[model samples]
Every structure is written in C-alpha cells, then in structure tokens.
Target: MKHLFLTLATITTLLLLLSTPPTTTAANAADNIVYDVIGEPLQAGQAYYMVPYDYSDVGGGGLTWLQKTKVTCAPYYVSQENVNTNFGQKIAFYPQTPGQTDITLSSILNIVFSSFTPPINCPGTSNVWSVAADPATRLNFIELRGSRGTRDLRTWFTIEDVDQGGYKISYCPRNRRVDCGSLGIVSRDFGRWLGVNGTNPLTFVFESEEFFLNKALGTKSYAA
Candidate 1:
C-alpha cells in the first residue's frame, strides 16, 4: 500500500509539472515584447515604430544602433502592420498622408502588412512594398548588429496629424545618419511628413521593440 501511494504521488507531480505553463522571467519578459505608448498621446491616424538603439561600443560607434527603424501609419492597425514579420524576418512600414475632408486621422491612418522581399543577405528581407499614399514619408534610421545574450533591441515613435484648414500636416521623427558598417547612429532630427499647411501641425507618437531571435528561419514562435 505504501509503495502504491508513493508511485501515485510521483506520477501526479510529474503530470502537474508537464502541464504547467512556462513562466517568463522579468528580464526575459522585457525582451521581444510590444509597448503601446509612452511619453505622449498616440493620435488616431499616426503610427510610430520603436526601433532599438544599442550603444555598447564607442570605437564601433555602437554597431547595434543599425537595428533601429521606423514605419508610420494613419490608424492603429497600420502600425500593427509595421510590426508584422514572417519567415524571412524583414522590416517594413507605411508612410503618412493627409486625411480626406470627411475622414479624420482616426479613420484614415492604420497599420497593415503585406509580403515583401528584404535586402540581400539580410535574414527575413522584404520586397518593394506599396505605400498606398502619395507625398508620404519613408526612411531608415538605424541598423542591427550581431546577437547579444537574450538582449533584444528597443525604441519608440510618435505620429501626429493635425487639421490645418484646407490641408493636413503629418510628421514622423527619424534619425539623420545611420552607419550600417559600424552599426553607429547619429542623433539628428530627420522629421518628415506630407501635406504641411504651414499653420497647424499635427503630431502623434508610438513605441515598439524588436528582438533578435536565434530560432531557425521560417520557424514560428509566440510570446504568450
């Protein structure tokens, strides 16, 4: 009887352990996670990409800064699209544009992602995707470098679209100089946008993070 009871207890314990979900540590949780908004209110039609800015080496000029990038959208969905990545793991984004008279920024601007071909030798590269807007702004701010020990990149962005009578003004903040070879970044205001009325300037901001995973290409992983 004693042996049977011990055996049952051991089996139950093993089953429980197997059924239990994996718990992510606080530090690991910070990696590969998405942050909605920080520092300012996110406008409806504006979107921001939180590109990671890693500054570890002065001689190399912080090669990790190259991983930073930006993608803008009018509505929130469009921003989500910018975050979407598939097997190849390329980064893509949309541009900002003026909203129609009847449509507000909240309705016109949104994040959407489609298939793309990334640059050569860049894992998860993307192709020439469409912007879906005219007179819009698009730019690359930084580049990523070799992997660190579970240390993912982090960055933030904001988008704003304010009504200025006959037209609308949109602005996205970008870094001016990005050293891909050395993976260094120079902090300069590369603010860009379209439909500026010269009077009322609308602004919005959003933040996001990018993690460099070691998983094999085309493998799927989820953060629950």
Candidate 2:
C-alpha cells in the first residue's frame, strides 16, 4: 500500500508540473531591455540618432553618420558620412508585431529615417528601409521600400546585441533562411555606403534627440 501511495503522489506531482504555464524570469526580462545611448530602454517609434560604436574608426575624422544619397529616381540609397552635421540623422523602428511598445533585441522590425522625404520623381513611395539592388551600383544596398512590393521579405530586418558589446543590424528574411548578412560600410566612389557585408558588421549605439538638445543647452546629462 505504501509503494502504491508513493507512486500515485509522484505521478500527481509530475502532472501538476506539466500543466503549469512557464513563468517569466530575470533572463526573460533582460531580453526585453534594449538600451539607447541615453541608457533608457528603446521603444518603438522613438526617434534616435545612430552613431558608430567606435566613432574614431570612421574616415575623415567624422563618426559614421547615416544619411541618404542624393540621387535621381530608383537609386536613392543610404550612405554614411564621416562627419557630424548638427545632431545627425534621426532613425526609428517599427516592430513587425503589432501593439508591441518596446523594441527588443532580435525582433523583426522596419527601420526608417524619420527625416527622409522621397523626391517627386522617386520610384518607391515608402520611406521604410529595405535591402535592394542599387540601380546605379548594381550592388545590394539599403533603399526605401515600395517598388519591390510591400510584402517583400527583403524589407524585414532584425536588431541584435553583438557579443562584442553593441547592437548590429542583420537582414535575414524569415522566408529565405539562406539569405542572411550583417550590415556594414563599403567604400564607393561617392563615399562610404551602407551594405550587407559579411560576418563583421558595424555596430552602433542610439542617442536620443532630446539628449542632444539638452546637451546643447548646457544642461546635465540626460541619463541623469
């Protein structure tokens, strides 16, 4: 009778354990926290200035500031300059999943330059960044979405925290697992442009617009 009672108790405990939902732990909480340069958690739709994680590595003594190429229709691509003009380009993220307030690491999202206004003659209507072949260079480069189809998997990207310490952008369409690469700078005749380089991607940090404004006013650090 004792052996039977012990067996029954063990089975009951196992059943209860299997039925309980998994609880959120500290590690799960950490997964949700992606901090900007100001040290605050990054949120969807918030504007930020992305600067090279190692500012000194950029050419011409300028930190790599992401800006758009001033080209004619169908080739308005994203390029980086080695200089800081004012506060630099403002970027924002839109998570693919609806209603998600905070942008988390490894989440599929659409990156957009908050200040870009497509030219009247531009081919695509979208300002959302997408990886497409540059008509001019015939090389795969980041360009505005739309002409390539609204649902193109190439429009999707993911943000991940690099093991070496900063955030890196990667393009790995869910539909095509084989199509994957990390974004880095490539030197062109015009200037350094953003491209899907190999494994060694350029990592960057986000600075809040408000932080720049406050610093300009001689105010204390925004993180303070």
Candidate 3:
C-alpha cells in the first residue's frame, strides 16, 4: 500500500513540473516586455517587404524653359482610391538575395520613412523608428520614437514564429486610443500573415481584432 502511494505522489510531482510554464530569464523577461508590445520577431532567413505612398508631389505645374514664371502649386490629396489604384506592392526584403539572412534570435531590422510626396503631415518630421529582434526565442520588439523627432506616435509589431509552412504576428501599441487612431489603415489585421512568399506578392495577408486602415496601408502598401 505504501509503495502504491509513493508511486502516485511521484507521478503527480512530475506532471506538475512538466505543466508549469518555462521560467523566463532576466534577458527573456525584458524581451517578453518588448515582445508583449510588438507582434513577433522578424526572422533572418525570411524575407520582408513594404510599400509607401506620399501624395505631397503628385500634383504640380511649372512654366516652360523659355518663359520662366513663378506658378502656384495645386493642392494634392491622397484618397483611399488613389492608394488602392496607383500603389503596387513593394518587397522590403528578399531572402533569396545575397545579403538576406534568416532572422535569428539576435538580429535587428530597421526601416525608416523619411521623404513624403507632400511631406508626412505627422507632427514630428525628422525621426527614426525600428523593429529589433533580440537573442531570444521567437521574440521581437519595435521602438517607434527614436532620437529624431517627437510627436507622441509610438507602437510596435512582432513576428513570433516562422518555418516551412508560415508565420505568426502580434501588434501592441502604446497609448492605444490615440496611437491607434493615427496609424491610419493597415492596423486591422495585426496578428495574421496573409502569405509569406509564394506566387503573388500582393497576396500577403493578416488578421487581428484592432484593425486600422493605416496599419493595412503600411503592411499591404509598405510591407507587401
């Protein structure tokens, strides 16, 4: 009888240990805080792409060379139709290329949008934001506000896992109410990957609860 009781206790203890969540190290804890904010890690071996549209200079009229005249510029505006019609998907990264590397635990990819067709009307003009993948398992973070400018727009996205089949994504933004509003469109499909790499680039897709048009613009238009 005693032997049977001991055996049951041992099994219970083992099961409890196995069921517990893995303990996160200090570095991992910090990374979790970051990943909790962003969506997932941008892997090295994988490829990424983005397409941006600026309507600042879409409309313009100048005089001929013979007759130099100072002419007023026409007001340019970018509508949803213009974005959907004119902009074609652009690849931000191509893994098959020479320099492309599979995203590992310790890798960082930074993409900045500087020039605007009409100049980004956002509050801060000069600034740099980045998506950083640290040396942690399936973890990534994004720093929206950098040393360049300050206009209260900050957020992040993460790539949690990537393999032969597909990938997973997550989005967490600071000041959700305000930042979410400014992000525009692409924000809607945050935690989903339409398609990683296949026949068509424009087919890339994602799904999430907090969807925004600007976020979609960034993903579909910028990171197509």
Worst 10 residues of 2 by lDDT: 59-68
lDDT tens digits by residue: candidate 2, 85-116: 43457888888888988888888888887877
Model 1's lDDT to the true fold?
Answer: 0.27
Task: Kindly list the per-residue Cα lDDT of model 3 for residues 28-119, writing each as its tens digit.
Answer: 64453211112443333222222222223222111001101223332211111223233322112212224544332222233232322222
In terms of TM-score, the best-performing candidate is 2
- TM-score of each candidate? 0.23, 0.75, 0.25
The CA lDDT at 113 in model 3 is 27
TM-score, cand. 1 vs. native: 0.23
**Which runs in model 2 stand beyond 4 Å of their true positions?**
1-26, 60-71, 84-87, 134-138, 146-150, 177-179, 198-200, 221-224
User: What's the distance in Å from true for residue 49, model 2?
Assistant: 0.6
Q: What is the C-alpha local distance difference test score of each model?
A: 0.27, 0.70, 0.29
* Superior candidate under TM-score, 1 versus 2: 2
